[model samples]
Target: MAFIFESDLKAFLFCLLQFVIAIVVSYSFSNYTNPEQRKLEKVAMLELKVEQTEKDIEQLRDLTRSLEGKYQNIESVHVPLVAFHVYNPLHTNLEVGQVIVYQTVPLNEGNGYDRKTGIFTTPVTGLYQFSAHICNQDNAMFVYAIVLEGETIALSTQRDMPSSCNTVNALTVASAGQQVSVQGVHMSKSYQVIENPHRKNSFNGVLLHRT
Candidate 1:
């Protein structure tokens, strides 16, 4: 009976060893069959990302070129101002007291659009104020505005503002080396004196200081 019990215990031990060995072999085989598959997937994903980045870079380059072209066009641009035949005596469009018709510099001496003459060429670059004023003997003078480019009316305004004995209207023009003119039938009187020609409205409208 003792021999039989020893034999049974040895068989059981042997069976347990076989089971563990089988499990280990199965696990190792599974890993070895597809060892490099995960690495290959990672490589493919990296390649896709790199391709997308290249496309993005190409698109950005195109956009940059387009913007550069537009900037070049803007740099070459020149804003044209309207001109009239001041020498023509038959020009009925000339109004009384219009400075463009007579004044050397048609720009207002007050830094305002008070002086509406022909186009005044810009001497320097920056912000410029334009203003106009009108007074009627009947106390019902209406003020109008038309901004022109050469012969084209870029803007016009019929908005009548209240006026004193000498009504005034004004606007600002940006940049330099452009032309400006009055676009109405009525005329305006210029200021008597200018203080600082360099500074806007420093004395009035005269650009006296060297830019």
Candidate 2:
């Protein structure tokens, strides 16, 4: 009976050793495979984050370019544009309803005034102020008008006097390529001379505001 009891105790010891070995192998395999799987999942998450960041950066660049283009367009359209002043130093004769061609320019800011043609062409759509001063050398009645786009806008009539002067001023809006000039008319049936040796006979224009 003792020998049988010893044999039963030895069989119990063998079974306990087998159970311990199986538990250790299972723990070791689980530890190695779990970390590798976690690393693969982390790498995939990082790749997705990087792709999303790249797309965000590209969208920002496109938005910046669009804003810059709009800013440039605004800058180009609203700048201050046209101004001119011209005078005639020599004495000149004029017939009735004739355009006075002022042949000298002292201040032509935008080069819109033509000294040869005696015309100011507007460079942009804006309100402008134009002024003309005329001095009659011959003691006779004369009338002068500020001509804008082939129509009179302002007129000044001087009575018969020695060295009489008349000034006409007009404030009007003009479009691009519109013309402005000064026209003179003699009340009598004779020509009139403008004596302006001191550069008194003058025409001036300036841009007031853009439309």
**If scored against the real structure, what TM-score would every candidate get?**
0.30, 0.76
Native-referenced Cα lDDT, model 1: 0.43
For model 2, the superposed segments whose C-alpha errors exceed 4 Å read: 1-24, 27-31, 51-77, 89-91, 185-191
Model 2, residue 27: what's the lDDT? 99
Model 2, 1-211: lDDT tens digits are 9999999999999899999999999999999999999999999999999999999999999999999999988876675857777777233656666777877787888888887778889888888999998876566677888988879999988765666777788999999899998887555525455654552788899998777
TM-score of 1: 0.30
- Top lDDT: which candidate number? 2
The sequence of per-residue lDDT tens digits that candidate 1 reaches over residues 64-129 is 999999997876553333222222111223343233332323333323232234455555554444
